[model samples]
Target chain A: MKYINHEELLKMEPQYRVQVINSLSGFKSANLIGTRDENNINNLAIFSSVFHLGASPALVGFISRPDSVDRHTLRNIQQIGQFTINQVNADFWQAAHQTSARYSDGECEFKQTGLTPHFIDNSDAPFVKESQLKYALKLNEIVPIRLNNTLLVIGEITDILCDKAAIKADGYIDIESLNTVMVSGLDSYHTSKRLSRLSYAKPGILPTKISLDGKS
Target chain B: MKYINHEELLKMEPQYRVQVINSLSGFKSANLIGTRDENNINNLAIFSSVFHLGASPALVGFISRPDSVDRHTLRNIQQIGQFTINQVNADFWQAAHQTSARYSDGECEFKQTGLTPHFIDNSDAPFVKESQLKYALKLNEIVPIRLNNTLLVIGEITDILCDKAAIKADGYIDIESLNTVMVSGLDSYHTSKRLSRLSYAKPGILPTKISLDGKS
Candidate 1:
């Protein structure tokens, strides 16, 4: 086993440290955050930080880097009060990765990456037409992390569009069936195979794998 | 495709809603957070919410549910000011999942789950001996999300232990080699295969997959 202390980690190169620390947390959710500027110019960027914050209110949150520089996604959310989160799949992960490039404010990533954007039910933000699973979120709150100067943008789920067949009876979406991709660090991509789904844990009982067809 | 509006989503059964919303975000990192109470009683709980916050200071954050019920993990972190995040792998994910059961405050989940607890460099918190990758964190700041009454606990990386062979020259850890399992919703587990790792994106140039052996 390799052991690294704080002092050693701090002395590493900046880019190397970023790769190490980012991948250290393990696999992250891969999604493209879609937003539109005041002129209705669409902007999309790949984000791996989005996580489920709460279920009752259906809240989700993602970390936005410092606002010292231009952040079109954050700016658009603040202005339009809405955005979309589309899961990145195998078919479009490369084009989705290209959205991370520093494009000019007026340029739309959707057009540049050849990803079609469509507005659903007159949504304020655009959704990726190629994404199999996507949802729209209304801006709920933004909490500032003074420790790192980053912002935690929280949103409430307002709408969802998904393949109905992928949803199980108990409401678990079979991601493996959707071919949704998972990301590691800043560049690595992966596709997963279901290992098993276990029954709810109890004190003395051992958990057994439950079937995907809603059988325990 | 299935379209679910906000009203419909709000009307679903609570457990079904949890399963749907939790899996809606796609794959999540599987980790076991280790903390010790004031009396040095160790506690371990499975969490899928850990996400990377920043790299400069090597910070990470996880959400703690509302304090309406007993939350030993949050309480221990507040009292001891330190904790360990251990990645969940195939060998012991069942035991790790069992940690989610509500154990009494004084009871140690580590012992009950059949996981060995070991201290490194006399660290305040105990780490899972069965885990291949683990890190110790010192409490940095606690930010309350008033929207849902949840708390986001931030921590700074202080120590790391991992299998050296899994780390690449560019600092990306090959999670496939580590056999780390990812979680979807509350119970599903998965193992992943590497798709590809792309080069950094630039304005006009297309990114090509880089080999793990340092060849582009």
Candidate 2:
């Protein structure tokens, strides 16, 4: 057993956890691809942590490291007050992850990753053309966590672009079919599998299986 | 490609996607167990999501969910203004998950799961006797996340208590020897495996042997 203070906790090595909450939701690979500032033209990165915070108002967020690194994605989101989150399935991971490089602010990751960037009206960000489950979000608020230089960036999901049938009657996104990957401890990625579903689940209750792998 | 509004975006069926955050970085499965509330007299079921939230004033949080059916955990925390979070090792999961059942208030899960409960000073919540890691968190603030009626409960960690030697010089806890289990998805649990220890992992470079899974 061990106990330590805040300073001690900070001393721990940072885990290189990879993948985000995107793409694993099926449809297509390359869930997010966007350009950096207009002048610097930097290339951004791809991740799966993009999550829906709420539905009524439509909000989304992704966690990122603090200012220690000049991340282009956060910069673009801050400067334009908007950015696009593309969808990536099994097909686009190679291209999507390619965006993780630290390109000059003037370089466009969209071009380097070989992804097509298209713009939508009434929005400041561009969308990924290849992603089947794409959307645009306007930066709403940046809630800085007290953690060691980590920020929980929350964004309002302004527009969602996806297949109508891909949605369910109960209002849940079916993402297992897209051959999505999940993030594990520090840089490890794993292909996700649908285990089960529940309107409500408790222990000892025979949990019924409704394979969420998108096969259905 | 499909673009939809709020109603349409939520129309998609929710899928079970689990990713490891490397947050529970202590001796796995250690906690102080204690009963909570007068009405929900049942033993309070708790788990570790222990991660750093802040440092200067000392803030931390654990990710806790409402009891699948009746919301015991949330109610307990809400009613008493305090509850202890206990750890379950690679061995405690069966009993830990068992506590998820809808036991009547006053029903002790400690009794049901065979876990020994130990009380602390001036506190009614008893710490789990068997856990290798345990800590007490005063009610700071609870942020309810609106995700598919699921709440991502965030608690401001006030005071943390652990075994001193559990932490190593590299600034990480040597929790692997404690035989703690990590959760993925819903029911899947795994033990710690040290693939490699990195020297200094920045954006482009990472420590070696973090995990052999791939492209780490």
Whose lDDT is greatest here? 1
Per-residue lDDT tens digits for candidate 1, residues B1-216, read: 899998899999998888889987889999999999989899899989999999989999999985622288899999999999999999998998888876676678888989999898847999999999999999999999998889999999999998999888988888778899999878999999888998887767777899874359
The TM-score of predicted model 2 comes to 0.58
Interface RMSDs of the predictions, in order, are 0.9, 10.0
lDDT of 2 by residue, A7-116 (tens): 44344344310111110111111236354465645445675345544434455556666553336777777887877666565565555555665555555767776777
Best by DockQ: 1
Runs with alpha carbons beyond 4 Å of true place in candidate 1: A67-70, B68-70
* Reference-based TM-score, model 1: 0.97
- lDDT by residue (tens digit), candidate 1, A25-63: 889989999999889899999999999999989999999
Docking class of 2: incorrect
lDDT of 2 at A156: 64
lDDT of 2 by residue, B1-216 (tens): 555654544553343111111110111222323546766464656443334343333344444545443366667666776655555665665566566566765567777678887655645556677766555555666654444344444443323444556433333344444544544323333454432332323234323434232323
